[model samples]
Target: MVQLDLIELADLVRPEQLVAEILRQNPQMPVPVPLEDLARLAGISKIEAFTSEGFEGALIANATKSQGAIFYSNRGPRPRQRFTIGHELGHFLLPWHRQAKFQCTAEDITSGGNKDWEIQANQFAAELLIPAPLVKTRLQKLKDPELAHIMALRDEFETSMEMTARRVVELSEYACAVIFSKDNVVRYPVWSPYFTHRLCVKKGERLPAKSPSREAASDPDEWHELDAHWWLVERRGEDTPESVYEQTLVQENGHKVTLLTYDPE
Candidate 1:
């Protein structure tokens, strides 16, 4: 493990609190959040590629969580690496994550199972890389919400489209939703807090046959009009609303992201 510059670490326990302290220290933090630099600042001594076949990232530190080395696999998409780095850093910093070493798999980083430690690490990574305040401020300055806006955020924040999309949903005031699908099968879906429509989404559910994400495959990242029922669960006695706008961003392979907005006349 190569040595890096050692910086003073903080005593905050919660993931959010520690990130707040980091932001407080680096008031002029830039977009895309110089993540590795921040990791080094938080006491990580070295970060190198890990050749482990299935693990996304790992942390090597003593029982007291000092003198840390982070490892990330080079095989995944480049966008995911930063998050993996942030995850290991989380494991290194959280006082209660008492493990001397952490070898986090893709599932552990992306979607943790029953382990609270992995879940907290994921939270730390998300909040550290994409601060909530920044997202809210950026969204307020933008015009009408569009999937293109999310695409722009993906680039600006240096995060995967799905990650950026989920962050936006967590803070957006508009009644909207994001759906991630592959080959017309829903994999993950998230809707804004303002969304009141009962969605039809279920893991492994077939995408609405006529949804724009599939029908307008030729034009990627374009918004189209559709009925709210396209993604909403219909009420037993009421008709589904009309004029729900959908903007779909087609991704590599069979992946697709559809943004839905509920606006009524």
Candidate 2:
């Protein structure tokens, strides 16, 4: 495989653009994108397994060259490992990511950070793994977003459930958001442009009393309509409608994903 330099890759400033260029160049690339193969083709010398304690993945460049090797944890699930590899590859291909080495933790790969490079790399990995165009098409076919639909999309894309949920929110026609929490505390929330209402909860905040996420502890995968005040803050004197729906799914590890949808009418 011929080594591809930054100039040869897309010159776009955003991660999504870079991914679009890659897909344009290789129209036949299969779903669940061939990350390892793409890495090798993009000048990654080796994809080695690491048993690191604190970090999920690392990209180390040679002292005299720009090309390097990618090392990912062998202990994480396959989906996670694939995402890590794609994230590291983003760091490798991004022109401004000039660091000779990068050691990234699980949070670095999974969440948006204050650093510009980390955010760009995450966007890149997401688009590479679950191309937005394809996701948009699939979402258009759904009459309503459901936990089962999200799970099926995750399995079809061979990506993490959180990733799939986020994509669903991004592409949904209705005002929607996906909240990830652990032990009742909010971790992060991803919402769509149409979702104008502000979420009352913030990172580390406990779930609202009437939240389906709280009920999910007992009945793991169920959808229910909760009072709007339970999750949204209404403006003074504004009439709050009762069309808010929430579905929560609890994983075996106690993490919860709550999908919120609102109907203004």
Candidate 3:
């Protein structure tokens, strides 16, 4: 079992290293390596599901060389399947990961960061697919940031929409946030340090009745700027202090993704 910290793992095999090693192993393609190839390189044998129910995914036990398998239900989208496989691979490689066959839900893979181990697995999966260095390089090329840029990155890297959005919120030079809400209730949100101190959006809080998320049901652009207190708690009888850039993305199932972006006032 290899033991190392997050920074050490980042130093050892970044996304570029992973890509380079994949290409070296399979010279037929210069584009990003396939997920199966990534699994094979990481020593996982096969990715298949058990004849079981109520399981989103799992890792097979007792494989040689600490290797494992990734099991998933067939009902998910292709991008989700790829993300699940990457998450399971994270468990397989990280020494601090639990040994049990991980049965994950969509929420688990997306918002399971309350625990240290779960957070580590999430970081591992993110870095494995879209290294921060690559993202940083790409961000350098763009003058204006938007959801289109994130989507382009996702398609370029062949990763999922959620992963791309999360990465952008993490790496954006602008003050940015990505809120995941279902049924108009807050689920999970990734925020920058600027928002961390003052912009507190509590879990399960209903969307602000006056926010664009409630009324802007038609615009599907990449980004927008709006009032700050519109999404933050306002002091009673105080004038609205700041404004924020609000980018709203509505999924097929009424899931709302609102990206709050603002510069320090």
Candidate 4:
């Protein structure tokens, strides 16, 4: 069993470093080896597809610290499968994650779980697919921040819109955030601390009416900004008043991105 301080390991292992370590362990491994191969390198051998009672996937037992089981339902899109596998792998590798099994759902991968581990796993997955340094260089080269640019990065990194949006929000300087909605209701929103305190969209609540997201036939490609009060609830007794700007991206596939901004007052 390899000994590692989980927190220290988390901090020490950059995505590239982890990938390189996998390659070193599996010398004959193919470049861009399938995610399964990486899992095996981490001591997970059994990859089974079955119907999960309530979880999308799980990793059961790691006594040897070199072998475990990975299970996922044979459902959903390929990206979702990849995400589930990645999520389980995260549990297996994180030293602090000690459980007989880890049960994860679709929302669990994106929205559920404690904030720190969820964020850590998310950061791990993001770094594994799209290294921050490379994305930073790309953002530097392309000064214009547009939805089209995000699509380009998605292609370049071979990741989903959600992954690309999170990284973009991190790299972008213009007080931006990404709000995901389903059936016209907000599911989760990720924002920078600068813009967090002022954001008004409530979880599980319907989107604002005046926003382009409410339009019957809205173009997901364009961005439109509106006043802060349109989305945020007002403070009843606060002395200082604040406002936010919103940009909407209604994906043709049904997902939405609401980019919120605030003028540095």
**Each model's TM-score, in the order given?**
0.91, 0.88, 0.75, 0.69
lDDT of 1 by residue, 1-265 (tens): 2122224344578889878777777776788888888777656789998688878899999777767899999988767998999999989888899888998988998897789999999999999889988888899997567777888898998999999999988789888888888987899889888887788878898888777677536454566787777778879876567768788877778888888887743
lDDT of 3 by residue, 1-265 (tens): 1212233343333333433443344444422326666676566778875444565667775533355668866777767677777777766665546474677766667766576555556666676577666677788897355666777888887887778888877877766778888878888888755454355566888877667776537465745556677676677765444776776777877787777766655
Clashing pairs in 4: 228-244
Q: RMSD of each candidate?
A: 3.4, 2.8, 5.7, 5.9
What overall lDDT goes with each candidate model?
Answer: 0.82, 0.82, 0.66, 0.65
Ranking by TM-score: 1, 2, 3, 4
Q: Candidate 4, after superposition: displacement of residue 211 in Å?
A: 1.8
Give the number of the best model, judged by TM-score. Answer: 1
lDDT, candidate 1, residue 111? 92
Q: After superposition, how far is residue 183 of candidate 3 from its true place, in Å?
A: 2.3
TM-score of 1: 0.91
Q: What tens-digit string does per-residue lDDT give for candidate 2 at 94-213? A: 877878799998889877567788878888999999988888878888757788888888988889998889888888887888899888889899988888887888999999987767
Give residue 117's lDDT in candidate 1 (0 to 100): 94
Q: Answer with 1 or 2, whichever has the higher TM-score.
A: 1
Per-candidate clashes, comma-separated: 0, 0, 4, 1
